[model samples]
Target: MGESGAGPGTVRPGGRTARVRAAVLQAAGDLLAERGFDGLDLAEVARRAEVGRTTVYRRWGNPSALAADLLSDMADQSLPRTETGSLDGDLLANARLVQRTLADPRQGRLFCALIAAAECDERTAGALHRFYRTRIAEWAPCVEQAEERGEVPPGTDHAEVVRAVSAPLYYRFLVSGDPVDVPAADRAARAAAAAARAGAFTR
Candidate 1:
């Protein structure tokens, strides 16, 4: 059976079309969390969302597109970067955000499911790459600011520095199966900041 409150009888206090889209996306996220990408069925999503199956089919066409759309929405809704006036502080903020997200039950599972889907679907992979690109871009300015302040050498690769801040956390989250905690987040931030200072990311 479909989830309660997502079914047709629920009233949403918004434009009908917007409500329908939100309901559909919410249903899709729930199913993705519950069953992974292989289990994402548009018909089921539509039924759960109280939206017509035909609308789902006509709009998304396939599960990959649906998953891609979800990723796009997630990227759009993600928090903006923190400006802490120091490389270490800003990078720590970034790492902590990544750690918190990976440590979240629903969000962790959703990310794992999306990554698995990307492995088997080119379009999904592209969407996933774009999502990361957007996130990295959002935080890259912190490193650029660090460079301007002479905390890091001139010509440091700002994006790489941003990527470094999250790499270890993601490695633990996606590869090592280790705990992602505040200490780990701090370590990742410190390591990235140290590397940037040492000119490891110089262009």
Candidate 2:
């Protein structure tokens, strides 16, 4: 909703407005990584962003709305999926990307914080779900292409295969406390590919 100035959750226009939004979101991310959602104060974000408090308040209303906008911005700016000509290769690329993001010091903590926020906040949870949907949709075509090549059966749940590639990596990131390493990523991709080959993802 924070893409225009039409309502309480609206973002701003381009040029200076876009710059302001970028700064605010960056600050929000940094704060979330550092102090988490409970510590996300509008005034602090405004101070960190060097924007007026009124601007932050008017544009994003509250911390939940600001976090939602931050998630939306992340989705909009995320890189497109890699196409590797095969389901395994494409899923490996997807798995590697997710692993890298989860292993990054700042990004890992930021994601953990956002996920924690989502557990107790409806708006943040919706935004988090939307963010994953965008990312999954970007990668779903890889499975569709695999289906075209008969690597997987028809009516396969392309999105589910994509999710399967990342699920283990996220488990390492958010739960098991294990290393989210390249080897783990490779295993995840391979496992998902094997599952899809067996029609585990078929509708």
Candidate 3:
């Protein structure tokens, strides 16, 4: 909904364009994490990225657009889902990945800022939703594989199972202010795996 109708940061540029995008997105992320959405100045971003101010304006136009594009870039750069043989193992792997990310100081702050931005900006919210959807889609296959192996009942909602694994971690990260640690991740994975096996996510 911001900038181009095709979606922010959807273009796959090459050569200098690719490098410019990489730099601009990096600068945007740093600014968002540091000064937040309210302070994300396109001119500052251009300066930090060493790109022309006109280019940043022409490409992104506004702070929300820049934030959306950064999110899109992050989604594109996220690691592929892990393939453990069992649902339990896969969920644990997924939980650990999320835990590690949220527990990281820089990444944690970056996410907090992005989530805060989403609360007030529709463009950022759409990008945030797309980011989660992409990540969920990446991990949902684990639940499908588990269904094939009879680890869970048939007709399980794969996306919900994957979402269940990350929900608790995010709750702690964004709300409860509890420690986002390995043990918390382990608990989340076990709980989600149990719930899925109990047919709680049946379609």
Candidate 4:
């Protein structure tokens, strides 16, 4: 299906690739949200994307791979980092976004299911790891800005600070069945900011 000299024309090589990727990702996401990881079928995704089965298989390979790309797409489309000019402000924004996503019924369950699946599947784990890496990197810049503003100590490990911001949300997502509301977002933000203020992110 994909080997018939498609010339990647149908896929737009670059632009088309992005377009088709978006379509496939959107379809895959809908399936994931509706069906969970186990229910996502590549064939259905191909049909929905109006792309060839070969294209779907050759491009993404498997359900886990598709799920990985789906997450990647979501991260790419996520809102740009907020620049609040203060440690608490920036951290709260990050925390709030994360909490809101995880607090959503479908998104939260999908993530929990994906993480659990990743624990036993290497391919899924790799994708999930890359997704988290992208997310953490996306939000790391706020911490760097904070350091430049003297809100936190110099040489703060921005990535760690970002990770800290997400720790509680992830904890709540995985450890407990508690609702990750606005207050939880605030707590995570404040806790991470406090730790960074005390040099937890230094080094």
Show where candidate 4 strays beyond 4 Å: 1-17
Cα displacement (angstroms), candidate 4, residue 3, comes to 36
lDDT of 4 by residue, 116-201 (tens): 77887788788778777877777788888889889889989999988888888777778886777889889989999999999987
lDDT of 2 by residue, 153-184 (tens): 99999999988988998888888999999999
lDDT score at residue 156, model 2, on the 0-100 scale: 99
- TM-score for each prediction? 0.91, 0.93, 0.93, 0.83
lDDT of 1 by residue, 91-138 (tens): 998998888887777777878888889999999999889889989988
Q: After superposing candidate 1, which stretches have Cα over 4 Å from the reference?
A: 1-14
Candidate 4 — number of clashing residue pairs? 1
What pairs collide in candidate 4? 12-16
RMSD of each: 5.3, 4.9, 4.7, 6.8
Relative to the unseen true structure, what is the C-alpha lDDT of residue 168 in candidate 4, on a scale of 0 to 100?
A: 80
Predicted candidate 3 versus true structure: per-residue lDDT over 112-193, tens digit per residue: 8989999999999999999898899888999999999999999999999998998999999889989989999999999999
Candidate 2: worst-modelled 10 consecutive residues by lDDT? 1-10
The C-alpha lDDT values of all candidates are 0.84, 0.86, 0.85, 0.75
Q: Please identify model 3 stretches exceeding 4 Å from their true place.
A: 1-13
